[model samples]
Structure formats: structure tokens, C-alpha cells
Target chain A: MNRLYHYPLSPFSRKVRLSLAEKRIEVELVEERFWEQDADFLRRNPAGKVPVLKMGNRLMAESSAICEYLEETHPTPSLLPSDADGRYEVRRLVAWFDDKFNSEVTNKLMGERVFRKIMGTGYPDSANVKAGSKAIKYHLDYMHWLLDQRRWLAGNELSLADFAAAAHLSCLDYVSDVDWNRSVIVKDWYAKIKSRPAFRSILADQISGFPQPSHYSDLDF
Target chain B: MNRLYHYPLSPFSRKVRLSLAEKRIEVELVEERFWEQDADFLRRNPAGKVPVLKMGNRLMAESSAICEYLEETHPTPSLLPSDADGRYEVRRLVAWFDDKFNSEVTNKLMGERVFRKIMGTGYPDSANVKAGSKAIKYHLDYMHWLLDQRRWLAGNELSLADFAAAAHLSCLDYVSDVDWNRSVIVKDWYAKIKSRPAFRSILADQISGFPQPSHYSDLDF
Candidate 1:
């Protein structure tokens, strides 16, 4: 059986989880306190990162690559489109969320509010948090702009792009960082994605110290 | 002909250049002043990011996605292995450099030392730069540990993983941020990649204000 070592609030881990569920690949979920730098976890990924997958004979890390590997290995319910251009769009959106969005929003807000405390880094800087809060509106606007033109962030079909975006936003939503009111289209898009059977586990994720917002598990919110 | 809008010191752009060169794809290189954010460049990628590729009729953005798209569309000399497990290993290492290395080293060091001056953000933060320098040693050690067992980063064959790791290290090396002597294996691996025909343009890269190191252009160091 495949085993996933991940943190509930990590967008990258959530992405892999969503992809596994999407492909109907059964895997054991092992919550890893990556910050602790456990010896066993380090053996799995010398990099000491979360979302490391232990498949039959292979261990893999990195969410995007893991998702692609799963997609290629398990062809049912594809998360990526067939065409090269379509695949490019999905990959671009995934990078946008994983790199850009994570850098701008998730790292700023989550890293500030929660991760800092968890890591014993320091108190959250309100300025950085404020900047993240403001920047999220702009990102939501961009999402709304994309959703306006297509059914999904990349195109008419739901791809890993949607899962990547949802993963980050869901984590932020858990900390009450997302303002769904910023864009109605984005909200509707989230509602649709959240309603997926694959997302049930993600919605049920609970961190010991951090309490979920009232609307985090609510599909209609 | 394909055109790449890039900055010499940008690791993301460098990764794309390395991939293109490895695939034997000739591209007209256009040095983009991402700091200036030209209107024309913005049209190419509204995010106004570097390493945007204008290939044939398709305009692509994001280094990771562009690299994957290139691998799919131009499969002649494959940068990614054919097998599912091999591909996973390659992609995982790619993400290690692009995301983890970028965050821990590039953003903290380069963003402070070089990018801040270019973007007029402020003077370089010595503390952040020091932290990045310290963090890079650990990352280099990790790379050495990975290379100790395998011929290349992912495995025996030279893959996208090598390019991804080299791309970031090259950028840091440009500003004299990397201590190459820390790991002989890592240094040898980089030297092997640096000697590649595709790395010629990257080695020849010149930024006006930031001068290159003595070994920057040397095939052998």
C-alpha cells in the first residue's frame, strides 16, 4: 500500500492527497511533524520536507512531481489534459499556486500566523500578514478573471491546477485568511471544487493548535 | 525561431535555458529587465515574471511547466526519463531546487543581495544574507549526499533534476555566494553540467552592474 507522510495545513501535501483521492489510489495518511526533523522522516526525504510518498518500492517527494507521477502511472480520472498546450496550462496554474501563491499568500499568512508559532520562530509580523491579506485580494481577482473566461482555472476541464489552487486557499481558509467575498466567481469555483468527494478528507483535516473557521467545512459557504 | 525573455541571474530563467539547450532547441535569447516590467513583456506574462518563452505559436510561462511542455512536445533527446518511477525521481529533484532551494537560498540570499538593489527595494539585509549562506551549506550537503549514491542528482543519466539544481547554484555562484569547496561531488556534478554545450549561453551571461566570478565562464574550475 502507498503511504503519504504529510501535514494537514501544508498546501503541497493537500495537493498530493487530493490527487491520490482523485485517482482513487488508496494510501495511508501519516501526519509528519516535518519541523521536528525526525530521523525516519529524514531518511524518507533527506531534504526533511513533508508530503513524501512511500509507494510499493519507491519513495517520492515534491507535490507537483508526485501528482504527475500518479497521473501517468494511474491513468484513470486524469488530472492533466491530453494535449501538450492543455497540459502546459495546467502546469502553469500549478506553478502559479505552488510557487507564486505559496510565496505571496500562504507563506506570508500561514507562515506568519501558524508556522512561526509551530516552529517557535517568533511572533507574527502584522505588516507581513497585512501585506499577505492585501495581496490575496489581487490573486482572487486574477482567479475571478480566469474563471470568467473558462470553466476551470486553466480551461473548461478540472485539472490539477484547480486542486493546487484549492489546496493553498483551503489552508488559508482554515486560518480564516481567505476573504471569499473578494470575488464571487472564485467563491463559486471553490464551492464546486469543495463539493468533490475527493475533498471530503481535506475538509475534515484538523490541526491540534489551529481551529478551523466556521465555514471551512461548509460546502455552501 | 523560439524566443526567451529572461534575466541572466534569474535561476528560473536559467532553468528554462538549460532545458532548451539540453533538448538541442535553439532559442533567440532576449534579456528582459524584469525590474522595469515592460508593457510588451507584461503582455507575454501578466504576472510579469521572467523566463517567458515565445515558442512557435504558443507563449508559455513558468519554468517548471515550460520544461515539462518541452519534454512532451519535443521528445527527441528526452530530459525526463520514460518510465513512471524515473520521471517521478526527476520531477521530485526539480521541485527540490525550484521550490525548496529557491525559497531557502535564492530568495533569501539573491533577493536580498542583488534583487533588492535592482528592484530598489532597499539595501541588502546582512542578516538574511547570512542566514541564506548558512542554509545553502546544508542544502549543498544534502545535494552531496544525494550524489554520493547516484551518478547524477536523480540517477545515473543526466536528467532535468541536474539542470534544476545547477540553475540555482549557477545564479548563486554568479554573485560569489556559493562555497564550491564544501562538497567535491556537488562541485564535480556542477562542473560536468557546466561543461555542456547548453550551458554555454548561461556561462556567457553578463549583467551590467554585477560582475561575474573568475570561474563563472570557465568550463573547468
Candidate 2:
């Protein structure tokens, strides 16, 4: 059986899990504390990141690459469009969430509030938390702007862009960092995606120190 | 004419530039001070980042997405492999350089040594420089290990992974940050890639304050 070495709160891990569950691939989830840098884990992935999928002898790292690889191998419910332009938009948004949104929002918010405590880094920097809080409103507004134009983040159809976004947002939502009332369309979009069966594993995820918020798993939320 | 808004020292911009040049896609280079976040530039790309590609009416952002789109539309000199696994490796290495290498090395070294002066941010943080300098050796060793196995960074074929690695290394090379004496195989890999026609424009790049180092454009180096 395929085994996925991932952490509960890692957005990257959640992104891969969503793709796997969406594609109906069976994989045993093995929770890995990747930051500890276990020798065995390093052997599997020298990059030393989470969401390493052990498929047979092949070990895959990098969430975007893994998601793209999964889409290529399993084409059932395609996450990317056939057209180049459509595909570009999907990948673009995926980068937006993973790179821009992550650095600006998730890293600031989650990195301060959660990872600091979990990783035993130090006390949370209130200034970073403040910045992250401010940054998230802009991101939510950006999402609202995008959702106003299209049914999904990338297009009318659900794609990996949605998963990439939901992955980050879900992790933020786990810490109650997300303000769901920010945008109705954004909220509705979340509601639609959060209700999907693919999101069950993520919703069920429970980090030891961090308790899952009730609204996080609520379909109506 | 196709236009690319880019900053000379940005690895992300250089990656796109290399991809375009490798694929022989003509684009008029427009040096954008994206950090300034000019209203017009933001209109072009809300992300306010450099390396935005304007092809006809379509404006594209995110270097990885742009490169993938270029590969899709212009398949003549393929930067990616035809097979899924090969493509996965290429993307993985690309991310390895872009994400891991950037954070560990480039952002620390270049962010301090170059960007500080160029952007007028502040003085170089010595601790960051020390950490970046220390971190690069490990990356070079990793590269040496990979090159020992395959002809190129990803595989035998010269893929985008090589460009991604070269792009960062080239920028660091401009600042004399790369220690060529570290690994012969890695140096040889750089020599091969540096001699490419696609690398000519990058080699020719002359930043205002930071004069191009003697070895930067030296093919024999």
C-alpha cells in the first residue's frame, strides 16, 4: 500500500491528501514530524519537507510536483484543464496560494501562532501576528474579487487551485485565524469545497496542542 | 512584440528569461522595479512581482506557471521530459532550487549582499550572510551528488531544473558568492549551462551599482 508521510497541520500535506482523496487513491497516512529531521526521512527526501508519498519504491517530495504527478498518473477527476491557458491559470493560482499567500498570510499567522509553540521556537511575536491578521483581510478580499468573477478560484470548475487555497485556508481556519465572515462569495466557495468528501481527512486532522474548532468541520460554515 | 517585465538580479525573473531564451521565444525585456509597486505595474500583476510576461493581450505572472505555459505552447526545444516520472523529477528539482535553495541560500545571501543595496532596504545582516554562506555548501554537495549520477540536474536532458539552478547560481555568481572550487562536477555543470546561447543575455546583464564580476561572463571560468 502507498504510504504518505505527513503532518496534521502542514498545509502542503493537506494539499496532497486532498488530491489523493479526490482521485480515490488509497494511501496509509503516516504522521511524520519532519522538522525533527529523522535519518530515515532524510533518506526518503533530502529536501527534508513533509508530504512525501512513498509509492512503491518511488519517494516523491514537493506538494505541487506531487499533485501534478498524481493528476498525470490518475486522470479520473482532472485537476487541470486540457487547454494551455486554462492550465496556466490553475498553476498560477496554485503558486499564488502556496507562495504569495503562504509567505504573506499563512507563514505570518500560523508560523507565529501555532508553529512557534509546537516547534518550541519561542513566544509568538505579536507584531508578526498583527501583520498576518492585517494581511489576511487583503487575501480574503482578493479571494472575494476572484470568486466574484469565477465560480472557483481558477475557473468555473474545481481544480488544484481550489485545493491549494483550501489547504492553506483550512490550516489557518484550524487556528481560528481565518475570518469566514470577510466575504460571502469566498465563504460560499469555502462552504462548497469544505463539504466535499476529499476535505474529510483534513477536517478530521487534530494537532495535539491545537484543538479543531467546531466551525472548521461544519458544512454550513 | 512579446514583453517580459523583469528585474535583472531576481532568480525568479532569470528563470523565466532562461526558459524563454531556451525555447527561443522572443520577448522584449522591460526592467520593472516591482518592489516599488507602481500602480500600472500592479494593474499588470496584482502580485507586484517581476517577470510578468505579456504575450499579446494575455498578461502572465508567477515564473513557474509562465515557464510551464511556455513549454506547453512552444514544445520545439522541450524543457520538460515527455514522460510523467521524468517531468516529476524536473519539476521537483525546479522547486528544490526555487523553494529550498532560494530560502536557504539565495534569499539569505542575495537578499543581504545585493537586494539590500539595490532596494536600499538596509545593511547586510552578517548573521544571515554567514548562514547563507554555510547553507550553500550543503546545496552544492547535494548538486554534486545528483550530477555524479545524471548528465543534467534532473536527468540526461537539459531541462528547466538546470535553468532554475543556473538562474540562482548566476545571480550569486554576479556577487562572487558561488565558490566554484567547492565541486568540480558542479562547476562543470555550470560551465556547460553558462556556455548556452540562452545564458548570453543573462551574462550580458549589467546592474547599475553592482558591476558585473570578471568571472560572471567568462565562459572559460
Model 2, position B181: C-alpha lDDT score: 98
- Residues A107-218 of candidate 1 have per-residue lDDT tens digits of 9999999999988999999998998998898899999999999999999999999999999999999988888888889999999999999999999998888877779999
lDDT of 1 at A101: 86
lDDT (Cα atoms) of all candidates against the true structure: 0.91, 0.94
Q: List, for all models, the DockQ compared with the true complex.
A: 0.85, 0.91
In the range B93-211, model 2's lDDT, one tens digit per residue, is 99999999999999999999988888899999999999999999999999999999999999999999999999999999999999999999999999999999999999999999999
Candidate with top TM-score is 2
Look at candidate 2 and give me any clashing residue pairs: none
Clashing pairs in 1: none
